[model samples]
Target: MKITVKELRLILTVDNLDELIHFYRDTVGLETSKEWHEETGNGIILDAGRASLELIDSKHAARIDQIEVGERVSGPVRLALRVTERIPEATETLIEWGATSVAPPTTAPWSDVARVQAPDGMQITLFATSTLEDK
Candidate 1:
């Protein structure tokens, strides 16, 4: 299987998009590229790596019957991410910034990746890549 673009940004609609944006900006160091407000709610487009993260404030409206709340997500929260080498440092920074961990980082079998949670309850997974020159 060959693909040019292997991934796309995951979008999560939350109750408080502003709060989530603040956490990602201050705690996780991702920059916001754009923001928009519609009749339904607001949306923030974050410039985490290459793709822009879309956080739409639609949780208040997603509670009809079609949306099934996940184990980690309440309302319409998502498992967003930022690629980092020092998972420990990333986790520590999240803790220092009032982000509560749903569970501590643990290595996933068959892969060199770690999973953690951010405050406002975002599932974060850190994976290792060998494309770094130096940090």
Candidate 2:
């Protein structure tokens, strides 16, 4: 048998659902893709640009951590976001909205990245890939 997938989305089960919704929509700037409440529970899906499933093992995740933050994240899950050159300014604004800094902006071999903890306690890496070669 063969299977095909069309779209992918990240579903976060958070204690503060409404707060997370506001954070991702207003703070992180992701538009609301879909939201609904069934008899079971409530769900909110935000449009994280160019969604794709990234399945990585611990070793690979550690490598990514080393490259991005010069260290390893304590958990198995970490969120990665690609932003523009305005990362510093954007990160400052995000911090104002309740995100705590895990690491300051660092220029890595692959991209410039910053590690942060979201209001919901998720580890996030804000990154920018555009280099001098891209200009």
| Top TM-score hit | 2
Candidate 1: where are CA atoms >4 Å away?
Answer: 1-7, 38-40, 51-82, 103-113, 130-135
When summed lDDT is taken over every stretch of 10 residues in candidate 2, the lowest stretch is 126-135
Query: Which candidate number has the best lDDT?
Result: 2
- Per-model TM-score, in order, reads 0.56, 0.84
- Kindly give the number of clashing pairs for every candidate: 0, 0
Cα lDDT, all candidates: 0.56, 0.79
Local accuracy of candidate 2 as per-residue lDDT tens digits, 1-135: 998877776667789988888788998899887889999999877887675567998998888888766778748777878776467876787899989988788787777778889999999888887443344
- Which pairs in model 2 have colliding backbones? none
Q: Give the Cα-based TM-score of candidate 1 against the true structure.
A: 0.56
Q: Which regions of candidate 2 are displaced past 4 Å?
A: 37-39, 130-135
